[model samples]
Target: MVSVALPQIGTRLSASPTGLQWVVDAYVLVYAALLVPGGTLGDRLGRKRTYLAGVLIFGAGALTCALASNLPVLLAGRALQGVGPALLVPGSLTIVRSLFHDERRRAHAIGLWSTASGLAMAVGPALGGVIVAQWGWRTVFWINVPLAAVLATTAWYAVPDVPGTGRQSGERDGDARRTGLLADLDIPGAVLITAGLAASTYATVVGQSAGWGSAVFFVSTSITVLAVGLFVRRERRHREPLVDLNLFLRRDFLAANLAGLAVFFAFVGAIVYFSIYFQHVRHQGPIAAGLSVAAIGAAFAVAAPISGRLTHRFGPLPPLTGGLLLAAAAFLSLTPIGAHSGMVLIIARFVALGAGVGLALTPMTQIAVQAVPDGRAGMASAVHNALRQQGQVFGVAVLGAIVYAHQDYLTGFRIALLTSGLVLLAAAITTLLLPTRRPRPASGRSRHQ
Candidate 1:
C-alpha cells in the first residue's frame, strides 16, 4: 500500500529521494530493532496483553499518519506503527505454536497465517490505489484505523490467554521476588541494538547522496560499529538476554534465518523498485501500477498453503530449495525487461516471483520455529522476524542506492534484478546444505513446559 503511494507521498510532502527512502526505512528499522524486546515482553508480560497493546499503538500511529501535515510527522507516525508490529508479530506466532500441538497441524496453521499475510499484500496495493485514486493517499492510512479496531475486538474474544513464562519453578527465590514488570528484561541490550541498527541504517541511506567520505557517513559508521560491539558484549554477559545468541549455534536455525534474510532482502528490495518503474518510467497511474503488481500477492496467497502441505510430505529442504531456485529464475528473467516490455510478460514474472516467495516462506518459518525449545518460541519468532525486517531495511537502502547511482532507471533496474537473482541462488544452495531428515517434534514435557 505504501509502496503504491510513494509517488503521491513524494509530491505531496515535497520529499527528496533520500526522504522517500526514510519513509520506508523508518517503519522497518524500528520494527527490526524492537522485535527482540517485544518478544521478551511477550514471554514475560503475557503474549495476549502485549499483542493488544501493540494493536492500540498501531492504530494510533495510523491515525497520526492519516492526519500528518508534513514529512517529519509522517515518518514519526511510521516509526510508531513499527512499534505495534514488533510486539504482535512474534506473539501471533507464539500463540499459534501454543494452540497447535501436532506438528502437521501447526505447519498447516502457519500456512494459513502466511496466507492471510499474502492476502493482505494482495489487497493492500490495489485497494490503496483505488482509495488513493478516489480519496487520496491519506485514506490509505485511514483504512487501518477501523481494521485495527475490529481486529482488537475480535481477538479479545477469540484469542486464548497464553500465560507468560517470567516466573518458572526453577527460578531462584531472589529472581522470583522481583516485582517490576520489566525486571527480567535486558534494557541495556535493547538500547544498544536499537542504536546500532539505527546508526547503520542512517549511514546506508545517507551515504548515497552525501558520499562515502562525508563526515556524516563516517560518524554514523563508527557509531554503528561501537553500538553493535557493545550490544554483543552486553548480551553475552547478561542473564536472560533479549536475544539468546546460543540459538544461532544450531545449524538448522542459522541456515533458516539466513534463508529468510536473503528472501526478504530480494523480495522487498525489488518490489519497491518495481512500483517505481511502473509509475515513473512506464507512466502508469497509481491504480494501474497497483493492479499490475497484484499478480505477485495473488500468486503468493495461493501457493503458501500448498507449500505447507509439501513441507509436511517432503520435509522443508526440497520445497524450500525449489522455491528459492524458482524465485531466482523469475528474477533473472526480468533482467532483460525494458521500458517497452509487455504488461503480460511483466505480470507473468511477478506471479512466478510471488509463488517462489510463498512456497519458501512457510517452510522457512516452520524450520526456524521448530529448531528452538518451546519455551523460547516467542524469542525465536522475534529473531527470525527481526532478521527478515533487517533484510527489508538493507534491501531498500542498498538496492535504492544501486538504482539511484546509475544514470538511467533501466540500467539500474536490470542490475538490481541480476543482483537479486544471484542472492536467491546462493540462498537455494544454503538450503540444500541442511540435513535431509525432518526435524522431530518437541516432546510432551517440552511442549507443556
Candidate 2:
C-alpha cells in the first residue's frame, strides 16, 4: 500500500509499465508463496518467537525499501517486506487464538483483532498517500519502523507465551526427538511451490506487456505450471506434506478459499487504480486523492466490529451477502462517473466500498480457520492469505491489461470497480457452500488423523 503512488513513480523509471507492475505484483506474489511455510514454521517454533522475528525482518525490510534508489533495489526490499508480513500476520492471529482458549473470549478477541486489522488495511492507503504527498513516496515505508519497534518492545514484555497444547506440543521436549508432527519437513515441496508461484507471477507481469508467445513469458509460465504439478505429486507422496491435499475435498474449506481469492482480487485490482483515477481524472491533488481512497478504511473501522457481531448472531451469510450486494451497487453507481462527476458521488461510493471490505475480511479469515481443525489454524490462515494474494496479483494482471489498453484513467478504474463488484458478488454466492456451523464428523472428531 505504501507503493500506491507507483503509477506516478513509474514515469520516473526506465520501464514504466513493467516496473510498476513488478513493484506491486512481486511483493504480493512473494507474500502469497511464503505465507503457508512461514505459518508452519511458527507452529513448529513458538508462535511468539516467530512473530517477533517476522516483525523484526519486516521492519528492516521496510527500512530497506524506503532507502531504495532504483526500481530493482526497491523491488528486492519490498519482496522481503512482503514475505515478512506473510509470517507476522498469520502468527499474530494464531497467537491470539492460542492464548484465548475459551470460545466466548476467543470470539470477542478475534472480533476486536479483526476490526483493528480491517481498519488498518482500509486506512493504510490514505496514510500512505498523505505521507507520499507531504514527504515523498519513500517516507511511506519509513513510518513502519517506529510503529513496529513500539509493537515489538511492548509485546515482548506483555504477551504471554501460548501453551504448546496442539501442534506445537508435538514439537516440544526439546531437540533430538522427532515425533509424528515434529517429522522433518518436505523442504523440496516447499521450494517447488514457492518457485512455481514466483515464476507464474513473473509470467503474468511480462505476458500482458509483452505477448504471451514471447520466449521469456512462455518459458516462465511453462516452468511454473510444471513445478506446480510436480509439487502436487510430491506432496501427495510425502509423509508430511507442506499442504495437506485432502483439505480441498471438504466443500466448506474449498469455498472459503475460493471466495477469499475473489474478494482480494477485486480489492487490490480496483482500489489502487481508483487512487490514480481520483487524482488524474477528478483533478484532485495527492492528499485529496489519498483521503478519498482512504475513506474506505474509515468505513472499515466502523463496519468490521459490526460484521463480527453479525457473524456471531446470524452466521456469515447475512453480513457477507448484504455487504457484497451493497459493494456491487456502489460499484454500479460508479459506472456513470463521466468527465464531470461530483464529490458527493465519489465519497458515497468510497464509503460503500469501505463497508463492503470490512464485512468481508473477518468472515473470510474466520471461514478459513474454521474449515480446518484447531491444530491446523496456522496453515489454514496461511492458505487463506496466499489465495487472496493470488487474487490480488491476478486482479492486477487482468485489470492492468484493461487499463494499459484503454489509457483513459477514469474508464479503466470504472472497469476495475465493475470487475471487483462482480467478483465479490460471485464470492457472496459462493458463501452458500460454507457450512452454517462447523460440521462435526458422525464419530465426533476432526476429519484429520
Candidate 3:
C-alpha cells in the first residue's frame, strides 16, 4: 500500500525524490531488519501474543497515517505499519506450520498462502485507486482501521495459542536460557546481515538517482559487500547464527530462491511501468489504470492453486522455468506498444504475464520453504520474502531510472524487459544444475527448517 500511494503523495506534498523514496524505502528497510527479531520473539514468547500485538500496532500506525498532514508523519506511520507486518508475517507462518504438519498438506497450504498474497498484491492498487478517486487518499488509510479492528478482534478468539515443546525432548531450544539478548538471539550476525541488506538495497535504490558512478553509490555498494562478507564470516564461526550459512549451498534451495528473485524482479518493472503505460501513455485515468493491472492479479489467483497441484505431478522446474519464459515473452511482446496501441493487445500481454508468473512463483516459493527444516521455517520464509522484496526494490529503482533517463517510455520499457529477461535466463540456467529428483530429508528432518 505504501509502495503504491507514497509516490503520489510525494508529488502532492512536493517532496524531494530522496524523501519520496524514503517514504517507501524506510518501511522496507525497517521491515527487513526486524523480520529475524520478530521470528525469534515468536519462538521465545508465543506467536499468538505477538500477532495480536502486531495487529494493534499496525492499526495504530494506519490511523496515524490517515491523520497525517505531511510526508514525514506519513513516513513515520509507514515505518510503524512495517513493524506490524514484521510481526504478523512470521506469526501467520507459525500458524500454518502447526496446522498443516504433513508434507502434502503443508505444500497445499503454502501454495494457498502465496497465491492469496499475490492476489492481494494484484488487487491493492485497484482498491487504492478506487478509494483515492472516489473519497480521497485518506480513504485508503481509513479503510485499514475497520479491517484491522475486525481482524484483531476475531483473531483473538479464533486463533489458538500453540506452545513450543522445547525441541523434540532431545535438543535444547537454546544452549543458554539464551544468555543475554545478543547471545540468545545471535544479534551480531543479524546486525551484519541487516546492514548488508540495507546497504545493498540503498545502493540499488539510489544508483540512478545518485548517479551510478557517484562516490555515494559506490561507497554503499562497498559497504554492502563488506557487510555480506562479515555476515558470512560470523555465521561460519557462531554456534547459533541468525541464518544457517549452509542453506545457501543447497542446490534446490539456492536455485528456487534465485528463480523467485528473477520472477519478481522481471514482473516488477513491467508492473510499475505498465501502470504508467496504462495511465500516462494510454491516457487512462487512475481507476482504469489500476483495474488494468488487476487483470494480472486476477489471473494469479487462478494460476497459483493449479500450479500447486501441477508441481506435485510435474516437479518444480518445468513450471518454474516455463513461467519465466512466459514473463520474458510477455515483456518482449510489449516492445511495439505505443500511444495508439489497441487495448486488447495490452491486455493480452498482461494476461500472459500474470498466468505464467502464477504458474511459476507459487511452486518456487514452496520449494524455497519446503527445502529447509521445520525449525527454521520462519527464518526461511523471512529469507524468501526478503530476497523477493529486495528484487522488487531493485526492479522499481533500476527500471524507473531507465525510463527517467531515456525520456522515451517505450525505450525504457524495452531496456527493463531486456534486463529482466537476462535475469530470468540466468535463473533458468541455474535450475538446470539441480539434480533431477525429489528432495529426501536427511535424518527425517523437515526440508525447510
- Top-lDDT structure, candidate number: 1
Alpha-carbon RMSD, each predicted model: 3.8, 4.9, 4.3
In terms of lDDT, model 2 sits at: 0.73
- Rank all candidate structures by their TM-score, best first, as comma-separated numbers: 1, 3, 2
lDDT score, candidate 1 = 0.84
Q: Estimate each model's TM-score.
A: 0.92, 0.88, 0.88
Worst 10 residues of 3 by lDDT: 173-182
Query: Model 1 over residues 1-449: C-alpha lDDT tens digits?
Result: 87667778999999998788778778877887788778877877667777888898999999999999999999999999999999999988888887887777787788888888778878888898887778888888998999899989988889877766764555521133357656767888988887887787678667866877899999999999999899888898998887788878877888899999999899978887888899889998877877787788899899999998788778889889999999999999999998999988889999999999999999999988877766678889988998888787778777878888799988998999999999999999888657788656656764664
Q: Give the Cα-based TM-score of candidate 2 against the true structure.
A: 0.88
Worst 10-residue lDDT window for candidate 2 reads 440-449
Cα lDDT of model 2 by residue, 1-449, tens digit: 55666755675555477677677776777887788787776666557777887888889888887888788888888888887787788788888777765444455566677778566766677676666667777777788888789889977888876432233334431122336434576788888988887887778778877876799999998999999999999989988777888888887778778877887788767776776676777677766776777777778777877776667666666676777777767777777777577877778888988788777666666767767655567777777777877787788778777766676766666676677778787888887877676422222231221
What is the C-alpha lDDT profile of model 3 across 216-291, one tens digit per residue?
8999999999988998898898886677768888888898888877777777656878888877887887777888
